[model samples]
Target chain A: MPTGSVQHFLHGSISSNDTLQALLHLLRGLCEDAARGSIPFLDQEISYTIQLATGNSSMSLRARRSLMYEGYPWLLTYYGHTDSADSSRLVAVRTCVQAGTSDELPKFLSCIGFKKDFELVSKGHVFKKGDMRVIISKFYNPVKDPTHPDGYQPLANEYLVEMSAVSPKFCEVLAREMHTFAEQLKPLVYFEKFIPESL
Target chain B: MVVVMLISWESPEGMSPGHANEKLQKKIEILGGKILGKWDVDCEVYSSLNGIVGLSDTQTTQPANLGGATAPQQAIYVLHNSNYSLSTFAILEDNTVLIADSSFDQFMPHMKVFYKKGQRSDAKGNRYELNEFIIKTGVATFGGSQQKILLLEITYLLSDYVHESIGIIRELAKLLLDNSFPGIETPITVREDKKFSPSDLLLQYKALFSHVKKPSTVK
Candidate 1:
């Protein structure tokens, strides 16, 4: 089989809500010609990572399962590392399955025999501009202590801004466009690929 | 990248397990097929999106729901080995395969777990460097229920051509089981007429599990 199209991705973060709003305003003007309406980022999404015991240590063998937007629900994706090891590249083979019912999720996971390791929840919005897709999401970690008023809280103040397209050929062009857009809001928000120490 | 041919072995009407095992073992020994090892394999079904999301109706001019709909027929599954060491994501719609990694969970946010089935089987004879004959008998159950359907799967592994290997496997089965085999004559061709990938093995397991879960006379 055909492996499907290779998706190119660029990651950046805005530290505050004010800067996020400013960047969104700038994008609205830049993508006026090909703007499709906005969609709820992620009303409520829970992500779980399943790992294999004998998978290569250097290379993590994990599959991600997410339930996003109570109305839309199930999305299952498998991620595999590509030949390139460049952290900035972040390329991988992604296989996806869209389930029709909530009942299918557990059955699918059990059939595979993978155990859930860590899970995180997130909420966000998605903006589509022609072939490009942008998501501004805030990830949250569940609180272990029962004393905490809220069951979960934002992992960080920063909001992840990811721009992606399904073609690698569009990487350079998209990068250039995103960079110029970032420059316009430089002082308000910084958008660039910044690798975290843990990842 | 081994090619596989699947043959189902159903015991004659009311034959007991002990009697069936004795006959199968004796036949294999007569054919000089040595037993290699035995283990259990588990399979699970998963989809790309969760819940009852509907796909857009392209025939009409209605606005598309974007990510709000689920396409059940397009769902893919990740089949794991017994120890969960190896996972293969098989896309049934297009027959695509991806060896999943730890980051899979992060990338697939809409993946939902479905049904699970486990099989216990013995490995016999080296068919290829990465291939072998597998005699499997198992039960597929949904959720926490004790109810299960019996399943039998025999796999002949080869890496080169599936059509050719399947013909060889048929002859082997005929020698071992005489007229007892299912005698399915349909050609077992790889999807898209491409060389088999590692994930193709898991596809076989998934197909068998689905069959047991929902048996259809026409399928």
Candidate 2:
């Protein structure tokens, strides 16, 4: 694959079913000229935060393994902060590999010697609008698998909505356009950038 | 596991460009560095906006709040090298570098392409197979209408130890370029260390970029 474009993302949340429907309607109208497709699958992602044993120092590594209904069985992703803590913006370099089996997860982690700090599971529906991708995902606590009859509880009632594109240069322009599209869905699904503590 | 040292060069002593190219090639032949092939290494730099955290290739601990969450001291960059081997250089704020086989295009949905440069060269020697000196001469192009810099990169693939090979590479460089190599006294040597990161490489490239972008004195 040609791996050289910088991706930009704007994230928000959709809390109500009515807002989702309205947002979808507005997306269809805006993406009419762009190639559109539905990712008719419940994509699951398990993100493993890896940390070096350095006390409470806030720099560590992260790995994410994802599986889609129609996609490959195991897609492993690893990334981390390449710069220092004082940079104005956060930039990370990430690489993805296809693991033949699920058993390779532990082996991969051990080889890198990064301790698993935390894990989060998310499942979502994806929509591709031209080069832009819109994902609405529901985060869940992985420790409580609903199938295992444990305390399975949704992380939150709101669905995380993300609008992303592959080009860094055009991100601001695209973000502006996305903001306009998101404004139409105001009060329904407000899309903005998510700021995690690590960032 | 190959160690590389990149040295930039320019024509010496009022020598014409054509004559300088011929002289470089002749010197390589004399040193038994056979012509291996040619390479066109292209790279594009992507950075995040001020105070915005973009995609990360690895997990990170939350940075301590330095006073207030204001502008940072260093800027992070994802450098995409589009040579035969595709690679991404993630330069962190603290000079931490993370290199990966995959590109940053997939992760950063919003990135800015600050600069683009293509280094086209005639590569010589099979450092991997023959364990000899690998040399390359190329022209690096930064954005502007007329900005191209000559680059000469020499690699010693025989040993993983950069310190051991530096003396030999320096001797060879002195003979071939006749001290025309820029930064010959302190060539950019990339050695393998736990802390050695892509940021080091980016710093070198940034120097080249600034040097090339400077107003030309030749005109």
Candidate 3:
């Protein structure tokens, strides 16, 4: 319920590599601190990336990061997403997360009351580009289990959360799309089964 | 075979039909072919050529075909010191070939780059190839989808100048069969054809690169 007690620090810029490396270094320390605490972070899903220009069409200011969502494995990926009109920028990011129970990632994140932690700083624009947006989010408090009724509630994971939004106003758009992304992010615990290791 | 030497014709106009090899390239040129690259089998003679040469579109193309669609072309040189013999068809009957624009083309042909024991250049040990031969033909028809079969021929080539640029022989066979409509995914029935499998070629390629032992299931 307290405000300004825990400030979610973010380093944003039109420059991708610079912003990403700084955020990563900060996240590493933040996760380390959060893990050391009594916070009940069953698993922490951290993902970030940098994107490059798709082709010679330099209309879209080249260097930037696209929609970064939490997923399994702290691995880097360079792929393309396209449609009939234009091709998405080439992106390479690493999604690193600690191992935990399968199908439990979504519930774990929800139980920690992460969605509610965005009440304060989660209202501003994280970053943006042509049809691209980045939103900042965080959850420090844990929401107790309703079924347990009488157990001492655990502290949910407390770490910096910064995500990309497609529009110029990233924060507001993410707040609107939060429900959809929450459903998507919840199953990240089982995302491992989708791609085979031997491919 | 994860890797294979791929050879596309430079141009039939320039290539004479004298040697045993230039025949396919000549055919490709007359047939209006698009030469991707070439896998030289007689690799033992690569020492005479430059370590690696990048040819612009104009350089690779014939005088008439110059200034056409061609990415930067680069040739990789290979050399081997260890003892290994040419792969005979009598040994096996199954293999898978692959080539990749990025990664995960292990089943496709690849050029394995290495630092030869004493060679000064990096390209000396690199083996280039396109293993997956998806021979395809036919166009989409009225009632059916594209009436084409994707045949995969897993082949590999060793670049030890002494050897025939890894797998140039197999590619030559595939190139020669261009007119016959050899499907890229053509199934090589081991029982009927009595030919070695893709896995056998894979091990042979690996053995050329290192001391890799062949698996039991591979024939």
Give the CAPRI rating of model 2: incorrect
Top DockQ hit: 2
Query: Would you estimate the TM-scores of all the predictions?
Result: 0.42, 0.45, 0.22
lDDT of 1 by residue, A119-155 (tens): 6666666777667677888877744435544345767
Best by TM-score: 2
lDDT of 3 by residue, B92-166 (tens): 111112111112111011112210111111011111233433211111111122221111222333332213322
lDDT by residue (A57-151, candidate 2, tens digit) is: 22233344454344343444433222233333322212222223232444433322234566666766677666767787777776656574323
The CAPRI category of model 1 is: incorrect
lDDT of 2 at A145: 61
Which runs in model 3 stand beyond 4 Å of their true positions?
A: A1-199, B1-21, B27-219
Better of 1 and 3 by TM-score: 1
C-alpha positional error of residue B80 in candidate 2 after TM-score superposition, expressed in Å = 4.1
Worst 10 residues of 3 chain B by lDDT: B114-123
| C-alpha RMSD between model 2 and the true structure | 13.8
- Fnat values, candidates in order: 0.01, 0.01, 0.00
